[model samples]
Target: MRSHHSLTNKAWAEFHVDGLPHVHRVFPNGESTMAIVDGLVHGDYVAAAVNDTAVTLTLFSWPASSISRYCYAIHLQIGRVEGPTGRLAVCVQVTAAREVSPVEDYWCMTVDERVALFDRGNAHPVATFRLEYENQRTVELPK
Candidate 1:
C-alpha cells in the first residue's frame, strides 16, 4: 500500500490563460466563455491544512493579469466525512444556489450580492472547484 501524505508542501502556483475575443462576458453571472481550465492537482494549489477528499479548478474567464490567475482557501471539515472507501466525495455549495442561472441568462440578485461576489479576497474560486490530490484524501479515521 502507498502512504497518503497531508498537503504540507504544495501551493497554488502561477498559470497563464488565453481569452476569446468573441467571448467577452467574464463573471459568475456571465454567459460568454472563451475557454475552460481544468485538470488540477495538489501540486497546483496551496491550502493551509488538512488533506482533502477532492479538488478541482473551474475557470470562467481569461485572467486580466497574472495577479488574477485564480485561487482559493476553503476550510474543509475532514474529520466529519463518513462513507465507504469506494465512494468519498466533497460537496461545495456555491453562493445563491437557487438564484444561479444558465450561462446565457442574467443573474437575479441585489446590488450588495453582486458587490460581495466580485469583491477581491485571498481566495477566489473560479466559479467552481478542482481536486488537487494524486491518491485522494482517503484517510479512514476511526469512527
Candidate 2:
C-alpha cells in the first residue's frame, strides 16, 4: 500500500505562503501554486488538483480553526511559468463552490464558483471544487 505521506505528497503542489494576498488561484507550473491562509503556514490544509495543462492549490482550513460561518478566505497562486524568471502570483477568494452540505468537511465553492488561472492583472478561473472539509486538506503533487 502507498504510505500516507506518499499519498499526501502526490496530491499536493508545494509553494510558499508569504505572498499572493487574495485567494482562488491556479498555476501552470507545479512549483508556483499555493494557498495562503490567514493564520497558517504552507501545507496547513491545502488541496491540489489538475487538468490537462495546469495545476491548482487551494486552502481548505486549519485543524483547530472554525470556517463554518466566516467568509472562508483562501489564497490562490496562478500564472505562466518560465524558468525562474516569471512573475507568478495572484490571490482570489474561494467561496461555496457547492452548496453547504450536511457533511461539514466538504469543500464549498468560491463565491464566483471557480478557481482561476491567468497572467498577472488578468482575471480567470481554472478549476471547480470537488471536496470540502472542516479541517485543512493537505496536498502533495507529482515531482
Candidate 3:
C-alpha cells in the first residue's frame, strides 16, 4: 500500500480556510476596513499555530499589479492575523477560526484562475497558528 505521506504532509503544511474575514457593516463607516491577502507568488505560504501544532490552509486572492502586460491568476492560503488593526470581531474573527474543514466551509472570491501566471513573482502576506486552544503557560513540574 502506498504510504499516506503525501496526505500527512498536506495536512500539516496546507491551510484550510474555514472562514474569510469580512467587514462588519454595523461598525462606523470609517471604522470598517478590508485588505486582500496578496497571493502573487509561489512558495509564498502562510500558516497559523493554534494550540501548539501548526495548521495548513488554502489561499486565494485578486488580480496582480497593473503594469503587467500578460493576464494572470491568483491563489492564497491564509493562516492567521499577521497584524490586524481594526476591530477584532469584524476584522479578524473569521480569519482566526479554531477549526476549519473543507466539508463545512465557504469562501468568497474563489480564485478564478482564468489567466496563467497572474500572481507570479509578487510578494504576499502570510499568517500562522498553533493547535492548542487554551491560554495556559508552561511551568516546570519539579527539578
Candidate 4:
C-alpha cells in the first residue's frame, strides 16, 4: 500500500494486491467527521465507509488459481497518546483474511475477536500507522 497527502489536505491511499490496484481518498468532512471516495477499477473490488468514529477501507479480490477468496481491510480511528497532555493520534488496524472457512464458522466470529486474532500474529504483514496531530496531521510511512 502507498499513500499521498495532497496540498489540499486530502489523504489518498492505493493498494496493489495480486496485481490489482485500488485507490481511495480520505478527507475531513467537518471538525470530527471524515469522508472517503474511491476510484472504480475492473476485476477487483474496493469499498470505503466512514462513521462517527472511524474510516474503513476494504479490498476484495478473486485469485484465478485458487478457489479461496482474499480480503484486506484497514481501519483508522482517532485516539490520544498516553500522557498528561494526551496528544492526538490516529490508531490504525490492518487485517487480512488468513484462509477460507465454512460460511457457518465465519459467521460465528465477531469482528473484534477476528481483529484480535490478527493482532496476535494469525495474519501476515501487519502494520500500524500513527498520525500525530500538532498543527496538522503528519504520517510517517514505513520504509
| Candidate 1 lDDT, 57-115, residue by residue in tens | 22222222333333222322222235543444443423211112222211333222332
On TM-score, the stronger of 2 and 3 is 2
User: CA lDDT of each candidate?
Assistant: 0.29, 0.35, 0.27, 0.39
lDDT string, candidate 2, 4-111, tens digits: 544234333334343232332233344322333463222233334343223454554322234432223244545444444443434455542322322333134332
Q: TM-score of predicted model 4? A: 0.32
lDDT of 3 by residue, 20-125 (tens): 3222112223232123235222222223333322233333233233332222222232233334332111112112111111212112322232112233345333
Flag the better candidate by lDDT, 3 or 4: 4
Give the TM-scores of the predictions, in the order they appear: 0.20, 0.26, 0.20, 0.32
Give per-candidate clash totals: 12, 31, 30, 0
- lDDT, candidate 2, residue 142? 80
Compute the lDDT of residue 85 as modeled in candidate 2. Answer: 43
Candidates, ranked, TM-score: 4, 2, 1, 3
In model 2, the runs with Cα more than 4 Å from the true position are: 1-44, 49-54, 62-68, 71-75, 81-85, 94-143
Q: Comparing candidate 1 with candidate 4, which one achieves the higher lDDT?
A: 4
- Arrange candidates by lDDT, descending: 4, 2, 1, 3
Which has the greatest TM-score?
Answer: 4
Best by lDDT: 4
